[model samples]
Target: MYRKSKSNGKATYDLREVVTNIKWSTDLNFSAGELTFDLIQNAHPIIPYTGDIITFRWDHYKIFYGYVFKYEVKEDNTVSVTCYDKSRYLKNQDSIVWQSGTIADRFNNVCKRAGIKHKVVDKPTHKVSAEVCDGKTYFDMVKSAIVKTRTATKHMYYIYCNYDVVELRRAPYKKLKIIIGSKSAMTGFSYAVDINNTANVVKVIQKDTKKSQAKSATAKQDDPKRTSFKSTSAAGKSTEQWGKLQETVNKKNKANHAQMVKQAKDELRKKNRANKELTIDCIGHIDLVAGNAVTIKINDLGKTLKNCPILKAEHNFGTDYNCHLTMKVGAEWLGNS
Candidate 1:
């Protein structure tokens, strides 16, 4: 998937598919290429003019079929012609030359129409010098050269085949439309899933274990150091008895301390067990882990929502131990446009 940051700070758009039904145009003289057919015009719409023609040695090329679609007279005493597509221009099936006169003419017209600018450039001579390479025929090579040339140029959001940019013209649409000329159908488009604003359905599941609760018990019985009572200056019999009594008390205390130590160890084991986890089949999926950001197409941003980023990526392990994901709700997610 191609990734880019959002142009607008508020939201980003991820394109899901290569949408069609857009308009496009090109520059071609009547001799080499055909002009679009207009019923009112006497010339065949798809036929090129073969007679002697007038050539203007200027920055842009213009032609006058039967009528002048647009005209501009500059201070230099040079009049220009602008051709507009009176009818629809179909893809592939029709080879029609679209125009709006000169670059200035098309620009002014497009400004009036509130549209962008798109240009198709001419192919280099060396590229079309030979046939297409690697199963690509001569026509395919020509088409490729045109598309590639346009793509190489800066500010070319889209490119088409057999199109030459003599001068700037009004864009066919108000928004960006990248149409891969029919020739490059094999390499149609690069796709990415639009995960924007999908947090409601794909929640992140936290992997944190809850803390166990129990009274804090000290292992005091396990402590080797303890106070002991001793008797001195007593009657010999009394002293002996006292000594015996002290020994018995010490033994009882040691046993009790040992029992408490064992109990403490057992309680710790139970707490560890509570935190243990296991893998199992036929289990439900949980929310993905919360993350920083994700990459996606620019056109996928819908009109309703805002920023959304990808969390954790999916992975596979040796069937025994697998990492789980936990997604927590948060603020805005950032992405490339």
Candidate 2:
């Protein structure tokens, strides 16, 4: 059953009876899910509108806590409501300065400035000497913090919203395993490899304030000078390469060149993994969500993908409480999985 309630616990509404359809989805790359649903408008006690706080619960699990951003009434007397997760509030809001603390501390500080409650499930061990959130939204600041923070093993962290709370956690390793085949719960599967978006090299430039100079570093896929090609039986190898250049102004005096190089390489790896994507569908797995580690075995491909992270997850519910899931899965090199 699905339920909507006020954030302050003042009132509650049971939407199961009137709900026609629901689409709840979340992503590791995005802070919030774009949630939408349709309801039969037959004198419902509460009218959902913009800025109203609503919590979506599927079965016993509270799936989403979001604020309604849009609503419309159809000619057929049905109401459609669109909502976004709490991170929507953080997207455009600025934060105060935070200095000399762990990534969790910085994250909590930003949440406090945004007036949102947050919880750190897995704290990142990396510590920063000084950090400032000037001229940047809370969302953008947190994303940068996640990229800077690393685990004891040097793996990057991930951020996501768990209902009303914001969670900072590490990427999934080989924790859960799922097999895809005709007899399994898997319903569909597909993959795509696009070289168009692949970047073999990344050039990161960081400006130095006091010195009035800019220090730059370049990270390449294989060899910085050599161009590598693969052989295909059908045709001779071609040398059409791709490259991405990123520049950031580092105001901090303590910024290290080695850290900047690592960051550049991490960014390149992320682009490479995103280029090779796989999507799969299955019966509703309530236990599955973004950031969960699962090993996927495909009989047709005759290969097992270990420590694959779920990039995106979509949960659909129908009139009769039927549920299904569609998820995008792939390797995220920054996670070191």
Candidate 3:
């Protein structure tokens, strides 16, 4: 079942009977689901439009909550609407200066400016000195803040939209109790190990800004040297086989050298993890979402996959009250619960 309403209004309309089809997907990296649905135009009085709110549910479980941004009236008298989770609001470009604080504070500030409703589930223990978002999109700025605020022990953070609220939470230390297999709820499963996009080495180059140079000059008059750039890399499993495939990132802003190095390592880790991936298709698991940890068992594979993080999920609901999902699962090594 699903509900639709104006962006910030109280009125809502149930859409279960009129719902024709749905395609909803969410990814940890993007922090929002690309949700779309089609509804038959009948005697219903409600009409979906831009900036409308949508909430999807499967039985008693809330599946998705988002805002419709696009709609099309089909020739068959049906309407197709495209929506994105609350994080979609962060895509709007803005400029702002942020004072030093924790990752939670930075994210909350961005949400405040963007008018995005949010909740910080996990707060970063570390603190950042200062950051500036000069005409950058809120998404980019918040992502950078998250990268910079990660702890030295390599604590991982996940930012995503849950229902109507934006969430910034620590990566799960404990795996979910649910299992996926032929005998389980999973209906189909496939895996791929592609080295084409795998990168063994990641090099990050952070350029020095005028402010950094000034600070350097003030801190050391005798040395009188400016840290113009910093670079770091990490080797992956395919490093030996592929002879070290290198990926380089150029950052225009100034950041701590150690932090930049960690960022590069994190990027490399993600790439390595993506190289070996499994796609599990099953009937809709209402509670399953990106950033969730779940176990998988395949009889033919002869081994159980444990503590796998969902990288993406695609949900489909069609006629006959049937709903299904295809989830992309992979390994994440931030540490164990």
TM-score of each candidate structure, all chains considered together: 0.15, 0.71, 0.73
lDDT of 2 at 227: 38
Ranking by lDDT: 3, 2, 1
Worst 10 residues of 2 by lDDT: 230-239
lDDT leader: 3
lDDT of 2 by residue, 41-138 (tens): 66543467677777777666778888888989877778888888877767766646777777788678777777777888887777765776778887
True-structure RMSD, every candidate = 33.3, 8.9, 7.2
- Worst lDDT run of 10 residues, candidate 1, spans 274-283
lDDT of 1 by residue, 1-337 (tens): 0112223342322211221111112221111112221111123221112221212111132321121233344444333333232111111121213232222332223223322232423222222122214533222222333333333332111121122121221111122122112132111222233322221111111122333354357653322333333321111233232232111111223334445444333332222111111111111111111122211122322211111222222212222312222211122111110
- Count clashes in each candidate, considering only residues at least 3 apart in sequence or on different chains: 28, 0, 1
TM-score of 3: 0.73
Model 3: residues with Cα > 4 Å off, grouped in runs:
1-11, 43-46, 197-240, 244-274, 318-337
Residue-pair clash count for candidate 3:
1
Model 1 CA lDDT for position 274: 12
- When 1 and 2 are scored with TM-score, the better candidate is 2
Task: List where candidate 1 sits over 4 angstroms from the true fold.
Answer: 1-142, 146-301, 304-337
- Model 1 has an lDDT value of 0.23
